[model samples]
Target: MCPPGTMRNSTGATGIHQCEPCTGGHYCEGYGNTEPTGLCDPGYYCPANRSVSSPQPGDLKCPKGHYCLEGTVEPYPCDTGTYQPNEGRTDCIPCQAGFYCESALEPDPQPCPPYHYCPEATMYPIPCPNGTFTYDNETGLASEGECQPCISGAYCRGGYIMDACAGGYFCLSGSYEYTPAGDPPPANPDQDPCTPNTQCAGPCPAGHYCPVGIEDPIACPNHTIRNTTGASQLSDCRPCPAGSHCLQGDPVEYECPVGYYCEEGMPPEECPLYTYRNTPGAASEGDCYPCRAGYWCNDTGMVTFNQNPCPVGHYCERATPYPEPCTGGRMSTETGRRSNEDCPLCTPGYYCPNDTINVHGIPCRPTYECPEGASLEVVCRPGAYCEGVTGVPPDCPGGYYCPLGSSSYTRCFFPKYCPVEVKCLWNVRLDTWRCHILD
Candidate 1:
């Protein structure tokens, strides 16, 4: 037998002819010459109906980007995500950069779309980063284009068209982050509270206050004053001053009117009853003065004009706005009394000294005389100095002495004596004559 891959031919002869080498694409590894032992080497093919009786046609080449096995009549396409570069390839290779091979049947890798990337051995395209865009027809082998920065306040996310940031949100150029709008830089040189990636900053809006960052706007506090709109810091708030009335979120100060008092950071309060504030801009309750004397102020918790005089028999003290009834035997026939002192004391001689009642027609003590309108009793008059007399005064006795207005008199104490002539008249001197007393 000839060595393997050699061919022997016979025409009904018992013995074999000399052996010959097999053709380039055919292999005859068996004994008798019938045909090449196998059709051809794997990855190569021969045509049908070729046998040992007639020499088989030379093996044909497989088509480009396709493969054929031994005895195969047709070629098969490469696998998905794979490709072949030359004709009659034994196996397929992974797709290259900037191209995509989606299926086995594809003859070659497809180019990546504009503004998109396709990695080596990839089957799909990937979009560019946000806030950036790439031009179509960018055919570099890098698998993607060099993305360009979008315009200010706009973003290009994964597409060719540029879009504007939504309200309260922003995007910066060459960035892929979208962020909410933030507060302005701190006004007082304080640290900024905003997080990174913020696109814009500004002051708090009017009618609201925002202290820091992108937090929600807060309504102004009660009694707020000045142009508080867009206030950025706590110092921007101006409390409503005294002598003024302010509502919540007020933009300007309002002066309190007469008869009203306004404290700081509060609404105006009306003056209390029996009080008056004749001037505007009263700052406190002390500014409301009490009503004048002799007038009856009856209202409460409000400014009043109803001033009535003190009623008869009633008097008002100094700075007193109400009338009080008189007591302690005090009386006044007058209409208006500024004070209780204006009530006169009871009259004299009528004995009206007690405080409870208005005494009238009452007389002084018996046997004791009193002057007109006198409050106390005095001794009886002179010609009436006798003792124990009720209705009228009695005259003094003939032997007694009485003084004017004296209650009693003294009696005269003396005895009578007569003169007697002495006998010695003769001899003597006229100067010596003496008188003698006779018992």
Candidate 2:
């Protein structure tokens, strides 16, 4: 019978030369006869040399960081990108996602480092691409997709985290760098920075504003404007000044038109009724002057005074919308009277009606009395006489009698004798004429 470590192929063996060591991967036991007993078990290895004793001399356990399979001749190191932490292992472990295994003899895989990523079975971590970044302290990034693209308004150069764009400069999404106004486009724009003057990124231009992350410069709205270049935010735009108007994106303000007034951030307004502005750039409502005296401005937006003159029989004060009629017993024959004082009193011996335009009023009758500024005629009294020349009736003379509304006086007729103190009359009761007392 052959020993445990040796085996013989032939059934009939003549000498020790016929006995052979067990195959390197297989084990021999119980005094093997003919063929080897069995293959080596997993996680173990066997050598070709044999002692032919109860315990094999060349059999050994797989070492750490190495593996062995059935019928193995020698221990095999774990493949690159794989690891084995335990001894006597049959197979190596592949590197996990988000981890890296650099050497076949490594005991364990390593976590992916910051700014880098690793895929399953990776031997090394890959750095984030240009214009992209990873968190400063982040680790275990599984794949290239884990790397983040640079945010708008911020930039990320290769191997760098993030940096905010400077004032008056702009950065777009996936930007590697910031751009300023008036700069030329960068060479290799895909890998470098954004181009100048393009919507991608640049400094704000005149009459416009550019906020962070903006693709293009924004125009200042109407009623607001900016003249200087490189405005970084909306606040940089200023409101249009009084007496001027600003259109959208205007670099300069325009003067208000004649007959109009303008205020900050507001459209032009026409001069109000009874007001006028003859020149351009009226700054506000106060800039419009009131209609001048002797003129009437009934309509709005007058550019000049005196367009409508005051008519006869009426007067116009400053800022008057309509002419004022002269008061009763007053007369005016001329145009453009500025005040009631311009109207004159009615003429003597004449009666003037209300709002009379005729300089000379109606004539007084021979029996009526009309004084200056008189609006109506007055009848003459019986004791007085009135002629065209008299504004007030004249008293009758001594020894004279005047009838109602009489223009002249009558003398007393002779009876016995004329009485100087009373009007002379006949005494009907007395046969001879006698002096009678007058009432």
Cα lDDT listed for each candidate: 0.53, 0.73
> Which RMSD values do the candidates have, in order?
18.8, 11.2
Give the Å shift of residue 56 in candidate 2: 10
The deviation in Å at residue 117 for candidate 2 is 4.0
lDDT of 1 at 62: 63
Cα lDDT of model 2 by residue, 1-439, tens digit: 7776788887778777778888667777767566677777778787777533322233377877789887677889888788888877899898999999998777778899998888888898888775677888989998877777666567676546466766555455455666534542221246675644233444555677767655445788888888876677888989989999888877888999888999988988999999999999998999999999998877778888878888887888999878887776766778888998887876777777775554557788888888878877888766678887457777767676665687987776565333444444335676443444458
Tens-digit lDDT track of model 1 for 1-439: 5545566564454433355665444566555544466566456554433222222333455656667666554566766567766665567777887788776556667887777767777766677655456766565334333556544445466746345443333233343333323443232223444333333234444444544332344545776664534565555666678898766544556788777888887777887766766677878888776766776656643454335566666676644656775454454556566666675543433332334333232454544554433334456664345243222445545545444455665453353121221111112566432223213
Best candidate (score: TM-score): 2
What's each prediction's TM-score? 0.32, 0.47
**Clash count (model 2, backbone only):** 0
Candidate 2 clashing pairs, residues 3+ apart or interchain: none
